[model samples]
Target: MLKSFDNKALEELNDSNASENERAKKGLKKRSDFGYAVLFLGPSLLLLGVFVFYPMIKTLYMSLFLTNNFGQTTIFVGLKNYTSLLTSASFLASLSSTFIYVIGVMVLTIVLGLALAVFANQKLKGIQFFRTIFSSTMGVSVSVAAIFFLFVFNPTTGLLNQMAGLLHLPQLNWMTDPNLAMITVIVSTVWMNLGFTFLVLFGALQAVPRSLYDAADIEGASKSYQLFKITIPMISPSLFFVGIVTLIGAFKSFGLIDLMTAGGPNNATNLLVYRIYQDAFLNGNYSQASTESIVLTIIIAVMTIIQFKVLEKRVNY
Candidate 1:
């Protein structure tokens, strides 16, 4: 009887497996299943091809030629435009400024965002209000923030100098002084980006299981120790996301530099994006501008690759 029962159970399992296989085969025959997918993805692919891919290819092709002041390609200069950019003083200065701006924004935004996220994650009354206030900076557009900072950092009638004067501190140039212009821009960019970073990290922090914290507490781990070991590792994915986004935003910053300094005080704040604008729009050096843009794109791509390679090792899956 036991042998008969075992054979019956095996037969039932085989029947179930056969049914599943039959269903899977029927599903494979359903070509209409992917129709909705293609329908959904078709528009996006078309848009990307038209806008992003086509422009990228055009820019690369345009970079090979020297353009006249009217933005027309006047000569087939080959790689001379790129070589000139490498050797140009203003281009070099802008490249240096770009690195500085990107790094400053990345470091400041991540550090401040993490700190704020940690604080905002606390179980306290009216915490939502604090979170909202902290993330409010994201609402301010780059142009608006630049305009606001323009007044804030004004030497005579500005809030910064006024406050310094009230405090009996010596007034210093903010945007006018070459040394401080990039720093001022960095500050503004960091502030503008902090809100999104904070929001991402805060959400990541909330997703961390409370049981992990409890376990850490039971292990007698200090808050700092727990934070470093558990919190950071767990939220590393979010941190990585914020880092990449901030880096890209910093590299593409145009409005702040345009409004605040206009690459002023002798091109002190002329970041790569602004320099590209200067070349393409202001100087009408379309070929050279395209070259600079390509260089900028390469730099961003290399840096992003480096970030993935270096940071991925430390990131907890």
Candidate 2:
């Protein structure tokens, strides 16, 4: 028995040594592969640094200095632009409008998208056709969508006005009304983005395992119960992705506001991006624009990080 125990111990020691040697071999191979992986990734990294990171740094640097008379003169004025933006009432108003727009669009888009995705997920006749019809708007350009909305909401000759007239309802001056102008922008943004979000959610819904639903049914769980208990948790990751994308898009919105409202009616729909454009080109305040841009970037980055940190904890996987 002693000799048998000694032999067993020797066998265990030999197995342990073999496992360690195998792990060391794998580690060496991984290190060797990492060099090739870096070599392949180098070009894309270089391009990203040149186009994205370098310009980002340059924008921050330019924010610290002022350029005068079409870049003919330069002066270093640190933090003045930021201070002025924070104190200016118009900037503050535009900032508030931007926040409203982001929140409005984010909520409406997600709600509407989820509804449409669930509807499309049903096993109905020509469901594929319906899905395609809903998602077709994603192919339209932002400027094109803005133009379409502009004509549709025209006070006098727009389709919406015509419909209202036919119904004997009052016509709305969507663009001229300061109160409605931002709402109009939000509606247009939601319309333009709803299809993409719907597709994302629908894909996630389809990816859920059938066995889970089968088990839920066998347990006498109602469809609604299963959906809330299983479907939502299963698709939480996709919802997180959609939420982040929609929020970022909402923050960066410029083309729609530019084409539709042009920040008119006392700058009712002037978002941060439009303000940046106005500062850089219309006002010729490059330093201020750069400062605003940097601030906007930081806000977006912080919000995105918070979103991931919070939502990641909720995702089942």
Q: Give the Cα error of residue 166 in candidate 1, in Å.
A: 2.1
Scored by CA lDDT, what does every candidate get?
0.85, 0.84
What digit string (tens of lDDT, one per residue) describes model 1 on residues 214-270?
998998999999899999989987787788778877888899888889988898888
Query: After superposition, which runs of candidate 1 have C-alpha atoms over 4 Å from their true positions?
Result: 1-24, 27-43, 303-314
Report how far residue 279 has shifted in candidate 1, in Å.
0.8
Q: Please, what is the TM-score per model? A: 0.84, 0.83
Candidate 2, residues 1-317, lDDT tens digits: the string is: 01123334555688998987898988754245677878999899999999999989888888888877473327877888778879999889988999999999999998889888878887788999999988888899998898899999888999988999999998888889998898899999999998899888999889988889889989999988987898778888777778778888899999998899998778899899999999889988888888899989999878766665655355565
Error of 1 at 29 (Å): 2.5
